[model samples]
Target: MATDHQQCPVAVIGAGVMGTAIATTVLGSGLPVVLLDVGQAELDRAERTIEIQLRHARMMDALPSGRAPGRLVTTTSSSALAGARAVVEAVVEHEATKVGVLTDVAGIVDADTPLISNTSGIPIDTLADPLPRPQQLIGTHFMNPAYLIDLVEVIRGRRTDEATVTAVTELLAALNRRAVVVRDSPGFVTSRLLHPMLNDAARLVDEDVATAEDVDRLMVGCLGHRTGPLRTADLIGLDNLVDSLAALYERTGEQRYRPCEQLLAKVHDGHLGQKSGRGFYDYREALS
Candidate 1:
């Protein structure tokens, strides 16, 4: 028999790509969702993004036919988080901002309801430190395009209990995503491996080794990578890349993780990748 939790909505904060994808994946798995954001316009845009992705999934026969489309609710009010079975925070990467959002969400959801962080590289322990239920908070770093990606890095914080980790792992399995359990670290695993390559790629561009397009092509043709490091950084947002690099460098004091001059210049110019219509490539005409 299905318990009442079968009907309880999962609450997702931050309405960005990661949050919306998280909500979309949960809905595809047949769970209701309450997605919260601070701005009405942002929530409206998130709804449109979700609808487009869901329609595309259905067209491709990727979405389960039995899944309900109208199961998601969007709100600007934090009060909507009440009675949520689990909460995932996917806000922009900033320590102070994330800490504040997590603390706020922790107060609304039930003590036992799992709280998850979708941060790419922020230390899970730092975010969990201030929460009332530190043991209940765990890191579930879902990759970009959350609905399509199956790999989720599950980071166990110093204070995170065994039960929380197991519960989150089971939840990932239910969503059809695989979990790679790892101990809390500066960049966990993926970011540490990926970001340095991206930084080196940017340095190549800075030193005029090759055009961004050519560099991306070499990785695709020679390296057999589906997407090159430069393009991936653009998709991830250059501003976000800077933040991630700074966090990694600060935590480990590693010079390789330092944001390169090219990246810094692009961010300074407000060319924040696809979102800003320009970064390594110009999407101005296409995005408009």
Candidate 2:
């Protein structure tokens, strides 16, 4: 028999780029989703974003056919999360903000409901610290463009039990995503290794070593990489990259993790990559 909570919608907290993408992925799997944010404007934008992404996915033959997409409910009320089957937190990468959101989510959802954090690099155990049911809290680091990414990094906290891990991994499988389970650590596997290289790529552009185009072309042409590091940074958003790099540097005290000056400058200028219409490359025409 399915429990009442099991039949309820998955709750996604935050309505930013990653949040909307996650909601779209869940909806693509035919699961209703409640997308919550503190502001109505953000939620409205998220709704539009999800609609467009869903259409694109369908056109690309990326979504499952013959099944109507799941219903999406946008809300500003935290109480709406009470009976969520699972809660995914996709707020800003700052530790304090995530802790505050997870702490509140922990109280609203059922005791058995899994608390999934879509944190890029922050440690899962650190985010679980504020929650009463720490064992239910885990990290599901969905890459940028979550709906299209086929692999997800699953981080298990120190107290995360076997059942929690199983539940999350199974959920990923249902969404047509492979889960690569990794031990809890700041930056985990992907971010820790990827960010340093991205930062160096930015350094090359900043020092006039090569034009962004030349650098990317060399990487793609010579290394056979699908996308160059700088272009990947643009897709990931310079602001997000800076935040993740800062978090890693603060947590590990590693010099390599320090965000390069070029990234900081780009973020300060509000040139946030593809979403902002400009970054290393001009996306205004593409976005328009």
Candidate 3:
């Protein structure tokens, strides 16, 4: 049953940027959150990153001033999620790795506890296959810098139950995000529309048609885009963008959705955008 004030002990697995953002956002929602990552080091880094994000969010008025979310608990043990009512997996974009995480967390959490994926483009149908309770599988696509972005796409898998979708949508609304219910399709709505633009920007830079600066200037100035596609890709992370595009193109056979060579090369060189302090434009340590 969907409740207005469901103060669940939410378990967020993964300590990367998105994972920490999920944990921090849930904590800010006044629900107890258990953050489980790969190991002690990752958890420690996650802790630091979240603290930085919260402070930044405060500066941006995204989070309340003079008050911080007090409902966060950190752990390296998967057992920490044993009694959790919901587990949100905010891990890497590999199917095999994510499946393993879903399987292990499902084993630890309560049977009725909903397992959600914070995936950008992974299809929930494939994820559901590895789980015993297929009806419980759902996707919550949080835009990068989760605490800031107000959009959370609630994607329903083929076998997903209506109740679970309603529950998660309500949960996201409680977190103060605008929840958009998207059907289970390759790239869903946001990525399907946004990725091609980003790829185009990458191609422009790759072909030396325009400098990165000019491209961004042209996009924001002439086109009136909030943030240019190339810059947005940097913020989203090239590797993640690549994975999403690859998944979309592979599943739907759309050539335009194919990831660009420059983008793939940047990912291989470890130029993972702002998070890594470099991408198209160099980030000089987390936006001052």
Candidate 4:
């Protein structure tokens, strides 16, 4: 039998931006979370990030009042995942890295506990291939600032069972989020459609067609997009965006998904957007 969601903590295997955001979302929903990372520094940073985000949410009245936030446990040990009601893998985008984490997590959590992957583009089936129970593996592509995003793209792997999908959708519902189930595909729906636009946006900048600010201005002001492609790339982290683009390109053999030279150069310089204070645009001042 599946464990009670209310009584057991959710295991978040990563302390990066998405992991931290997901943990914050789960905690805000009043469910305890075990946040695991390989680095103590990263775990410490994640804890701080969660605290600040939660505090800000409370201030903006984004989180419900009069309910204490759920407890958060940060650790570097996979053993801490024992008895988790569910496991969310938000590790790095590399196939090997994700597969390794999921394989380890499978051994710790209950056999029936849902395993959700927050991969931006990787096919859920590919990640599930090495797992003991592929049916329990599904993808929950939580958008950036997961606490604020109301919709999540749910990907059903070839072997993913209906029960796993139902349980995951129900969990998301409890967080006040809607899940749009989509068939498994390289990059799935969001990244397949999104990365091409981001690539073209970067190419425009590379070719001197427009400045990053003006490009974003055109998209936001005239195109009715809330955020422009370049800005979105920055928020996603240029490094991570490049990795996703490369994966999409490799998986689909599509030229449109190729990472632009400018983006690659930016990452090489470590101007990793909001995280590094620079990318398509400088964010040091804003971040400071």
Q: Best lDDT goes to which candidate?
A: 2
State the lDDT of candidate 3 residue by residue for 1-288, as single tens digits. 432225557788998878888887877655678899768898888888888877777778886444558577889888888767678998888888999999988776665677898887778998889898888889988987788888888899999998788778777777778898888877788888889999989999999999888898899999998888889999888988898889888888988899999899999999989888889888976555
Q: Can you list the residue pairs that collide in candidate 2?
A: none
lDDT of 1: 0.85
**TM-scores of the models, in the given order?**
0.94, 0.97, 0.93, 0.97
Candidate 2 global lDDT: 0.91
What is residue 238's positional error in candidate 3, in angstroms? 1.1
Total backbone collisions for each predicted model: 0, 0, 0, 0
- List ranges where model 4 is wrong by over 4 Å: none
Writing each residue's lDDT as its tens digit, candidate 1 over 1-288 gives 222443578889988767888888888777788999999899999888888777766676656567565488999999998788778888999999999999998887777777898888998989988888899888887877677777888999998888778778887777778899999888899999999999999999999999999999999999997888898998888998999999999999989999999999999999988878999999999866
How well is each residue in 1-288 modelled by candidate 2, as lDDT tens digits? 334765789899999989999999999989899999999999999999999999988887878777789999999999999888889999999999999999998887777888999998999889888889999999998987888878999999999989889988888887888999999999999999999988999999999999999889999999986788888999988999999999999999999999999999999999989989999999999878
Stretch of 10 with least lDDT, candidate 1: 1-10
Residue pairs in candidate 3 whose N, alpha carbon or C atoms collide under 3 angstroms: none
Arranged by TM-score, best first = 2, 4, 1, 3
For model 4 the TM-score comes to 0.97
Per-model C-alpha lDDT, please?
Answer: 0.85, 0.91, 0.83, 0.89
Alpha-carbon runs more than 4 Å astray in model 1: 1-4, 59-61
Off by over 4 Å in 2: 1-3
Instruction: Report lDDT (Cα) of residue 250, candidate 3.
Output: 83
